[model samples]
Target: MSLTAFLHSRHGRGFSCRAEIEAHHAAAFRRFRARVMPRSPFYRGMADLPLKALPRMDKARLMANFSAINTCGIDHDAAMQVAIRAETSRDFRPLIGKVSVGLSTGTSGQRGLFLATPRERRLWAAIMLGCYWPELWRRQRVAFFMRADNALYRSLSNPLVRFAFFDLLSPFEDHLARLADLDPSVLIAPARILAMLAERQAAGGLALSPRRVISVAETLSPEDAALIERAFGTRVHQVYQATEGVLAMTCRLGHLHLNERWLRIDRDVIDAASGAFCPVIHDFTRESLPILNYRLDDVLIPDPDPCPCGCASQRIARIEGREDDVLWWPSVTGPRMVASEAIRTAIACLPQPLRDYRVVQQGRMLHLWLDAAAPGAEPALRTSLAGLARRLGAEPPALVFHRGLPPETDAKRRRIRVLPEARTGV
Candidate 1:
């Protein structure tokens, strides 16, 4: 199964055309209707219903109906207790039978609970190892940096592979010595953490060679990717995963293609003009915990052009952060979801060599933070943004500028975010 799934990920291996993809979906759903749907209490009598007819699910709704939705008879409250204990104690060894329970960091409001059976764990390991594993012949070390650890991740361990878990809760500096000793052949971490390590490498404070560097969990920006490449002298690969599942993964050509082998994604287009939308995923692979008609808050911009890698799955140009991260400015068409790239371009074209920045919108005010080479950056950024607003046919918000960047934390770094819901109508 591992080898087959691994081969399926390669271009022209799993899905060659739209028709083939549709056929795979048809078969998978057929199996689900016959074998899987009957077991789920939440979806008990809904086997004959089409996907659209099924209840639309989000994190909140899933959690509310967790006990009934899951095929396994695991109680939601019992699973939550186990997950919380493991998190607080920093011990990932515990499990409920063969099923592994873990918590989501919840960049959104409430923390989410996820469960995976042994079969699920093996499949996950197969896809990850098959795609990102550096060398199979020789024993290689894998450095996995995550907010929390779980048996779900431990499936990657074997005699030929030494999986090292780097807890994000600990000080970043303290892990340097261990990292040096491990000198892992495959390095995986959040985008910011990878960038931080890249910075260290550039500064000559760290010296280690890795065959693969994978950015996981959070959004990996173009600038940061370039920085990582320059520092490591290797192309940076990305794994677009959420608690929902491994939604997408970068191909050999470095283009992100939705994991259509395991998932059926339906885009809920938020902005018709920009073609940005959140993914409503139906993962036929996840049976222990069914994730059907589930909408994730992430907003992804689609790439219309075909990938050279030849994977017929949907191509993601970039993840434009969460829905809350999108700022809706007043436009002729009412509240328009402003293209974040436009704002980034405005700041990028600035004459100053700005190192970093943050943009957060609160009510009618746009708070801009600049870590620039010169104090003159504030006025320059303001003018650029005003021009952008004019070009987009939108009204410029009150620009409140601040010098320097926000303090670094373990939290996922979101470049642009909307603090409150914007008034859509004038």
Candidate 2:
């Protein structure tokens, strides 16, 4: 084993030095190459190239070479079957390692299962406790809101840090009652839910002042951040966590800094010409399944300004919305394309009575799913929405009423979806 891995395994500590982190990654890559190259026929074909020179791998390639690539003998089919069972059984926690397994909702047709090693769970607990609640690790109640049941709780729950799993599939009332009784000190949830809570707090319907509110799973937009900050009555922290794992986080100034010790974020950019630039990541911490030079579908625009915090780890400006979420509205002259921010702006201008909404695109037709509690919302909302649609060069979409937007299994809230026909121009 590499010195860093050996040290980490033995001492349960992480390196803060940039050079040391880089060296550890190089060593890990070497071991990974040696182990997988000979056993996995797929990687064996690419063994001639330098370990660092191998092309970035995407989800398709990783899934295709699953059994061959995994350092463990866990086959792709078996792992997938476990994930499927977890999704269908209504049991959030399926055993994986000493931790639990939660399946991704697969909004983008790419689904993968996350494995949390026992040591990884401990590290996550320690880091989170240090960051969120340093005063008491075991005492403060933590209420985590996510679609899939989290595995970290199984390992880390203690008398002090009592964990209450609020399944996203459950009714909102169930969560409200649980929170009212628990009165958790730390509240971790998606930004949109916080936004809803903020609205409730304003109307004097909900009252729970949390010491810390950590928003993760989705990109925390500026408006969402402000709303969460106002509702929580505390500085809202952002965790750039996903199915992959905890990748980055906001420091004291709320700047998104890479977890350089565990992962290497490939910094790249898209010029005015290119539509999207995929990020290339090398996760040093992942040994069971190597994630070197893995291309992510999401796009992140790099920030030029140096963070005032002076942390050596690289930083990025606000994570821009994914390319897939872009909305194409119909204008009088042509089709007008706008991003999530633009759509958010239009929705924000509407009356606050609209509880929830979703915009779905099918070919040139847009579908608006509104969960409104107020009467006469449709008339006012329809007019405003249709005007915006026309401005975007998109025809008025068919309006649909949904009791509630379905929560994605991947922990991501899907505000929009593009049908296959739209991509094919059918």
Candidate 3:
């Protein structure tokens, strides 16, 4: 990657208005489309076709037609083998030649393999630093805690930027010790892990003052965000990313703005009343694996007001979890899909705040998992959930409460999920 080009693209020009940002996105998309149409078999006949007219692609489709979808002639099975090896051995450095392979945690019901060239990795690093790090040139220490490590993530580590990765699968005590020693200026982790660290910070178990705390890989609840902010005396910023790419990051004004300069997004509005939509993304920065109009399952709420930061990029009000996480129940007429926000609101109305919790629906059974920290809070939780069911005008499923729920082996936490078998109709 050209350092000059990366710096110029990120910092040289500014979008004074939304029109200018849209124009930039249009140009980028055109360039990307022109480049990929002839090279990718999947897009071979889509030269002059409109984006909407093109068949929408999803995780399963992408994986099934991986070779045809990707411009690089990497075999899907070979890439999957490399990704699996990295996951089993916890070593993410082995590349398919120059291409880096990383595996998704399969939280969305299917595992995904992401490939990126060395240049693409550098560009990604630049974009991340440009968006999140205010003092880009200043020497700083960064602590990134996640389920898996990747060569792409390690590319950001340098003499000036001290980057350390803490594996979530490791013992909690081990992470605490390492965190205290590293004393990172920028701390990034899943919302749940950040909350745990905040509890330790409040109790004086950990002694570090990170300038910026970024939440990723999990939903950031308002309760958890407030606690983290109070503990660190800093706002808990967010990075909305997945195995596909870095989709958005919080601006200086704390609004999560889509990376429109590098990505073209087509919103598939699900709820017009609530300004909620699912994003169909086309990432122009990725070369090895071309992501064109790939629709994600996650739902996003758009901000009505403009961001104060003066960047005309589209701003997301909030991430409302995945469509799959929405619980389905039998209704008088048809299957009733319960929104995640309603469930979250019901849980938040409890008398006591839960340290961590998850709601899973399986075959007319609702399994509630609460951390041991919130003792005796289950009664209130149950009451609130029952109230939600009553308000929805549906029969409440059997509720099963499990105290002291253990964390998953991976860092990706699904606070709300619906089992595949139970997903069939009301």
Candidate 4:
């Protein structure tokens, strides 16, 4: 069967049944193992282990064995070169055939590429449509915002859905103009940008009202989440997608539901004391670059209770921050890094006015990039920000003021960046 036909048939199937889901996953896993083991030099080396005995893998190991991990036909360096070329171009679609790649914008300090086979992409489309917008299965209009690149754009398009790509590189005014014409029913964008759009909608500058406002790319801080919710007058749904693949998504009740049917999560607990698990996923949905027990950098605290939304799927809190987002306590004489979730927690606690900002650490100093609504709001921001920094341990670092936060060329806003300099004056 064609990937799309087979996948579209699987929607809302008894796959949601735990017993059935487990059986399907086991069968899929075995099939994937059979396909990749003999052909992939990387998988071949580890083929001695029964599927149950292979050690869970991490990113470092993946990178180390990248050449061997992929299916026999793919050339890793060639694929990367194509991805880079696709990322740099302006066409509405990319050149990769039977291969789908989407770039990720996160402060993980690594450029992530989500690779999928034709089959995986088809399945992803089905599930995304089934859970997030069942209406789309019939024909609908979608307005999506992201850094403009043909490859990324191609992935978001479908014959059943009319999609208009909003380039973050374009001025907000331009988006408002085009959106007024597109009149799409759903708006999916980065959390901060969506919040900005919501503000414009409130100001009467933008006229389109989307039935759903989906937030992606960045972690939606609670304060920002409430702001978008209030500004748009719609429940903001969260989508957890990375260059790796679709990680999890928010259900109607605002609980994060993992896409476990396609990907199995073998979680590693970061704070074993608190029972907080970070994900190490085995994605059987795709074979081109099947992700087997691949550890990811995100840190999340799983939700223990069943979601009030009534979906039996596994759910968890939004990723709090990357493992490396921890603030390092400055030491007068020794290795300076120390355990502190202060940066993530402090930023989350900041009042609504400071909607978009970034914190950078250079040795002993903390630098904040502020993008507030009011022009003179810097004074209020200065006070609260410096206070937060001090509470994080550095006495008080230098604060830099800018009219707007700079979006990286790739269109990502880094929330926390670690500087190379050993120290910076407080």
**Clash tally, candidates in order:** 0, 11, 1, 1
Alpha carbon lDDT at 363, candidate 3: 80
TM-scores for all candidates: the values are 0.96, 0.72, 0.85, 0.75
Ranking by lDDT: 1, 3, 2, 4
lDDT of 4 by residue, 1-426 (tens): 344533532343323456666776788788777766767777776755655467666655655565677673656566667667766664435546666555544554555445566656566656656555636346667888887444334444677777788887778777787788887777889887887887787788877767778888777766567877887677888888766667888766667887776677767776654456678787776566657777777777777777776555677765766666544454353233323345555545545455566667766566666666455556665676567645544445555656566656323444666655633332
lDDT of 2 at 420: 55
Q: Sort the predicted structures by TM-score, highest score first.
A: 1, 3, 4, 2
RMSD of each: 1.7, 6.1, 3.5, 5.4
> Clash pairs of candidate 1?
none
Clash tally for model 1:
0
* Regions more than 4 Å wrong, model 2: 1-52, 92-100, 134-138, 267-276, 327-339, 342-426
Query: 247-319, model 3: which lDDT tens digit per residue?
Result: 8877776778887877888899876657678899988777788887899888888888878777777888878
- Window of ten residues with lowest summed lDDT in model 4: 331-340
On TM-score, the leading prediction is 1
Best by lDDT: 1
* lDDT at residue 384 of model 4 (Cα atoms): 69
Model 1's lDDT to the true fold? 0.87
Error of 4 at 358 (Å): 6.2
Greater lDDT among 1 and 2 belongs to: 1
Q: Any runs in candidate 3 off by more than 4 Å, and if so which?
A: 1-18, 328-337, 351-358, 362-413
